[model samples]
Target: MTDIFGVVADATRRELLQVLLERYLAPESATGDISVGELVEKLGLSQPTVSKHLKVLRDSGLVAVREVGQHRYYRLEPGPLDVVEEWLVPFLSVDSLGGGLEQGEASGAFAAWSGVQMPASLRRAGESLQHPSDAGAAVGRAMADATHGTRHRFEEASEAVERKVFDPIRKKLKKD
Candidate 1:
């Protein structure tokens, strides 16, 4: 079935989603639309590639587009994906793991899972996981310097995340 899951499964589409999400969350946007040129620049993808992904997003109803003179501006709708989220949220996090298991006894999740009647089994597992020495070793060796990406690539990535990821998430949190 061609659902939200299918639409987002492509890496290119996910990158486009990230771009749109950032633009939508920008403080300056009264309307959530972002232009194709902006997406092309941000994703470092060719214009044709961007347009193709945008078509998929539009077909899935995950994005809506508006025409402005010669330009087509696209924005995320986000509502249709709720069904996928509902189905997937159970795997995201189990509710306090089952029930009455207190904060510490379970150590991690699955502690509250009601099916595990004997907390003793859970306790034993937690005990084994306990590390005696969390001592930070002083290294005489210099750090192995490595680059995550080229300087331009890193800058572009950082800017996208700052604009498209963090800003939107912050705005949503502030609402709550």
Candidate 2:
């Protein structure tokens, strides 16, 4: 789906998107909302100019607005971001390269061509960090885990429901 973000990739629209994202990330007031005046001050753009950018942003689904009394507050909408992420998957996948990357070659001829660069120590650290089960691996473990359906370190969920509910309380009580 061609989204507002596709339209928003333009320089002016992107600047507006960045401003909106920043506001959502760090809200200024009780409602954490921003008005056209606030955006004008923050971006140093005129009211109508900011409004024009905002209109494009709003039309593209990159932003959402709410009316409170006489004010209109704008914030980012993350739903379209998911679609963009999915669309980017093929570009992110290494399997598409086929036949796997050859060793030594991974750093020399191939690396030179692909613009890959890394310090020796950093490369060693990365090598040491490889999953034991996947000997000779160099890609990120999170991507490996995802491809293999292995549970990610941060994504662990307790099989025991009661324990899941009580563990946090237990920690708090113990602390008390």
Candidate 3:
């Protein structure tokens, strides 16, 4: 499946995708949608210029456009992008990457929401991110993992991200 990310490997398209994603993901976005005028204003691009990028995203099936009378509203469709996300899961996943934030809380606020008491080890580590001296060591300890089982899976995932997504973007961008 083609994704906005594929087309958005272009800097211009990335800007448009950022606007759409931010607007769509925002809690107060207009109807959870954005109009072409709003996109132009937010991105500081011309209507036709923004429309051109929108067309690319729409054609790639990464975005959907709905027409209400004369205005068109665009929204992100995660299906095509899921291919990219899934492909990059290894490099981005906490389980695979080994040093990233925990599941469900990208900022690592698992204690409050998970109803699981923060382990003293992690609490100390989290507190350490606040201190300049212990920050580096704290981060290292927070990310330590026993490399018993998941190495091969992460290797395969890393390879996929390099081959399928990163390499393609690099090759495409390097073309004359």
Against the true structure, what is each candidate's TM-score? 0.56, 0.50, 0.50
Local distance difference test values of all predictions, in order: 0.67, 0.60, 0.67
Residue ranges of candidate 3 with Cα displaced over 4 Å: 1-5, 93-176
Backbone collisions counted per model: 3, 1, 0
lDDT of 3 by residue, 97-159 (tens): 234344443323434555755445455556646568677775555444322224556678768
- Could you tell me which 10 consecutive residues in candidate 3 have the lowest summed lDDT? 89-98
165: Cα error in model 3, Å: 26
lDDT comparing candidate 2 with the true structure: 0.60
Instruction: For candidate 2, write residues 1-176 as lDDT tens digits.
Output: 34645665778777777767656654344544678788888778899988888887777677788988888888877677766655444334323233333343343233556766533433555677647655345445534533343232213443353357545755785899
- The CA lDDT at 136 in model 1 is 18
lDDT of 1 by residue, 10-69 (tens): 999998998787678778788889999989887899999999999989998989999989
lDDT measured at residue 36 in model 3 versus the true structure, 0 to 100: 93
TM-score of 2: 0.50
